[model samples]
Target: MFLAFFLIGLCIFYFYSIKKFVFFSQKSIKHDPPVPIFGNHVQVAFGRRTQTEVFNSLYKRYPSEKIVGYYKGTKPEFLVRDPEIIKHVLNTNFSEFCNRGVRRDPKVEPLMLNMFSEDGSVWKLLRHNLSPAFSGSKLKSMFPIIVSCTNKLVTVAKELALEGKEFDACILCARFTIDLVGASGFGIDMNTINNEQSLFLKLRELMFIKSNWQMFLYGIHDLFPESFIKKIHISRPQVRLIIKQILDSVRSQRTNDTNPRNDFINLLLELGKVGKISGESLETDANGKYKEMEMDFNDDHIIAQLFIFFMAGFETSSTTMSYAMHKLAFHPEIQQEVQREIDKSLAKHNNKLCYESVSEMVLLELIVKECLRLFPPAGYTSRISSNDCVLPDVNVEIKKGTKIIIPIQGIQLDPVYFENPEQFNPKRFLHETLQPRHKYAYIPFGEGPRKCIGARLGTLETMAGLAAVLNKFDIKTSPSSTRNIHPNRAAYLIQFIDGGLPLRLTLREKSSVISNGFP
Candidate 1:
C-alpha cells in the first residue's frame, strides 16, 4: 500500500512539471525546447555560459523571428531582436514595461534599495528628484574634483613610464575613478591612486569578488520565485555594516550644515529637507493630464542612492577609459589623430584641461563613442511587462510579468547596421556616415525616460581621464597584452575581460606634454 501511494505522488509531480514547462507551446510562441525543472537556462544557471553568450546564441538561431521565447526555469522570457520592437518596449510602450523585476528587501539589504533596483512608483519618484542633481551646471561645479584625480593619474602614468613597468590598465583606471568618486560624490579623499591599501578600494574589491556559493545563490535567485529568494539573505554582514558605519559618520559630520557643496551628498541632504520626492504619474486622468505622486526621502533612501552613484560612476567610466586606452595602444595612427585634436583644443585654451576645452575635442569624442559601441559597460538591459500588451511593430501579445531583454552587444555588432562591425572604426559616427543607420540601432546608454541618469557625468569623466593619460605618455602594447579580449563568464551583469588589460607606457617629450597647471 505504501509503494502504491509513492507511485501515485510521483506521477502527480511529473504531470505538474510538464504542464509548467509547456507555457510557450500553449501560447503558440516559438521557443527553444526546455528540459524539465532546469528549462532553457541550465547552462546559464550553472555558470557554464554567460548571459550574453546565451542571448547571442538565441539571437542568431532565430533570424526571421522578431521575438524568441525562452525560459529561466519555468518562467517564460522574451528575447527581442528587432530594433523597432526594442524601441517600442523601451519608449512608446514604456508604461507597460517599466520595472526591471529585480527585488530585494530594504530591511535585509539597505544598499540594494537604490534607484537601480527599485521599480514602479518608487523608481519614478527617485529618478525625477535625482535627475536635476546631474545637470550641466552641477557637473561643471564638480569638474575641479575630477581634474584633481586626473592629475594624480597622470603622475602615476609618468612614474610607470619611468620605471618601465607593465601594468594592468584596468586596475590603474579603477584606482583613478575610485578617487574621483570619493572626492566628487562623497566629499572624502580616498587617495586610492597612490595608496594600494586604501580601505574603500579593498572593501569594493571584496564586495564584487564572486565565490562559488554566491554564484549558486544568484542562480537560485534567478530561477526561483522572489518570495523564496527573499527568505534567504545573500548580502554579506560585514560589507553592510561597513557601509552603514561610513554613511552614519558622514551624516553626523554634516548634520547641522546648511550650505550646498554641489556634491552628491549635499544634493541628497537637500532632498531630505524637502521630506518627499515627487514626479509625474504614469497613469493619466480622463483629460490626459498626468497626476503627481511622491515618496519618502529618508536615511535608507539616502544611503541607497549614494551606493548606486558610487558603483555606477566608478565602474562604467573606468572600464570605458581602460578599453579606449587599450585600443589606442594598438592603433597608433588613430591615437595620433586623437592627440592632435586634443592638442588643438588645449592650445586654444592655453593648455587647460577644463570643461570647455575637453568638450571641444570632437575627434576624441568620436573615438569614445566608437569604443562604447564596440564594448558597452552593461552588455544588456532588461524590462518586465506590468500588463498584457501587444508589440507595436510585431503583432505579438505578451503576458504580464514576462521578461524582455534588449541585447545591446548583439544589436551593436550586427553587420546590417554597422559596416565592418568587427573592426574599430571611429569614422562610422561622423554626420554623413551615421545618417543612414536606424536611430535605435545603437544604444550604448540605452533609450527613453529610463536611460542612464549619469550619462553626461560619465562621458566627461572618461574623456578627461583619456586626455590626461594621452597628453603625458604614449601607450603601447606590452608583452602580456592580447589583441582580442574574451568576456569572463563569471561576471553576469557587467562584462569584464577574461584576463586583465595589460599595457606598457612611455613618456612623451616635455614639449609635447601639456604641463601648464592642469592634467
Candidate 2:
C-alpha cells in the first residue's frame, strides 16, 4: 500500500537523520542529559521550569565549556556561556550569525516582517533606515511631551494617595507609559489612565493575551517548521484596526501640516513622502558621489516600522520602571537615598526639573543601571546562524539554523558578575571595588549594531516619569508584596511577576519643582 511505503520512508529518513547527528556527528559538546525529541524542553512541558532556568542550569553544569549543545525538539541549540564567544557571535564574526533564528515567512505571516524577525541584508538595510530616527536630538525634541504625560500620571498618583493613602505604583506606571506611547509614537493623546476603553489599551490587551493554546501553537511553530505552516492562527483584529486608523490619519495629516509636530509619527510621515517622491534605495554614482536612490516606500514598510517602535518604546521601559519601583518599595532606605539625590539636584536649579537637569542627574543614571541589572527589560536574546561558524575556543561548528541565546537574566544574577546578585543594592554600581565585571555580562539593551535603537529615549522617558512620581510622594513596599519575583511564563520578552508590585505611597510634605536649565 502507498500508506505503508510512506510510513516506512519517514521512519528511514528520521532514523538516518538522528544517526547523522548522534552516531556520525561532526562535533558535539557534553550537555546536561537531554530527553528524546523535546530534549531539555520536557521540564517546560510540565511547567516545572522556564527556558531561562534551563539555560542557567546548563551554564552551571558546563561552566568550563565555551559552548554547550542541546536540542529544542530535534534541532540543535547552542547555549553560549563564554563572553568571548558571545562577543564573536554578536560582533566580531557577526555575518555568520546575523539572523535571529525565528522562521516566519513574511509571505505567509505578513505581520512578522518587523525588526525582530528579519535577517541578513534585509535586516541591515531596515536597521539603517530606523536607527537615524531616534538620535539624541530627536529624543530631546520629544522630552516636553514625555514630561507632560508624567505630569498627568503624578496627578493620578496624588489622587490615589489621598483616597487610600497607598496604591500599586506599577499599575500607574504602566498606564502612564501606555499613554506616552500613544501620544508620542502616534501623535494621539490616549489618556489611558482616565479612559479605560481607549483603543491603545485594547491593542495592548491583544498583544499580551496569554492563551495556552496560543503558546503551544507558537512553540510548535518555533520547534518544527512543518507544523508552523498548519498551526491555528491568532489574530489581533483590534490592533489592526488601530494601526489602520493611525496610518490613515497620519497620511492625511502629512499632506495638510504646514508645520508638523517633532514626534515619531511626523518623522515617519516625512520618510513616507520621501519614498513616494523619490525611490526606496539610495542611488550612488560610479565615482561614488551622492545621487538619489529609487525604490518606492510602501505602506507596509511604514506601518511595520512604526508598529515595532510603538511596541518597543512603551513595553520594555514600562517593565523596567515597574521592577525599579518594586525594589524601591521593599528597600525603603535606598528609596530615601534616591529621593534625597532628586531633592539635592532640584535644589541646585530654581526648583524645576527640565531636560538639562535630567542629563546631569548622575546618581539617577547609576540607579537606572542598577535597576536594569536586576530586572533587565528584554531578559534574554537569541540569534540564528547566517552561515557555518565556529566559536572562539571550541572546535564545534554551528551550522546555519542553530539558535544561540544569551541568557541576560542568568548572567545578571550570577554572583561572579555582581556581589550578592540577589540583593537590591544600588550602591554596587556606584562602588568600583572588589572585582571588575565583564562588559557583556549585563546586556540589558543588548550590544553592537543590533542594540536597542530607542534605548536612550526609553531610559529618558523612565527617568522623567520616576522623577515626577518621587517629587510628589514617598513610596514603600506594601505587606502584600512577594518575597521573590517569578515571571508569568506565558508572556514573551518581559516578565511581570505575581502580586504586581503593590506599594504604599505617602504624600511628601511639599511637592519639589526642580527647574532643569535647558529649554
Which candidate leads the pack in TM-score?
1
CA displacement after TM-score superposition, residue 207 of candidate 2 (Å): 1.3
lDDT of every model, 2 decimals: 0.83, 0.71
lDDT for each residue of candidate 2 in 331-435, tens digit (9 for 90 to 100): 777777777877777777656676776777776677788888887867678898866777677767667766898877777888777888888777787656556
For each candidate, give its TM-score against the true structure: 0.94, 0.89
How close is each model in CA RMSD to the real structure? 2.5, 3.9
lDDT agreement of model 1 with the native: 0.83
Backbone collision count in every prediction? 0, 15
For candidate 1, give the lDDT of residue 28: 76
lDDT of 2 at 115: 67
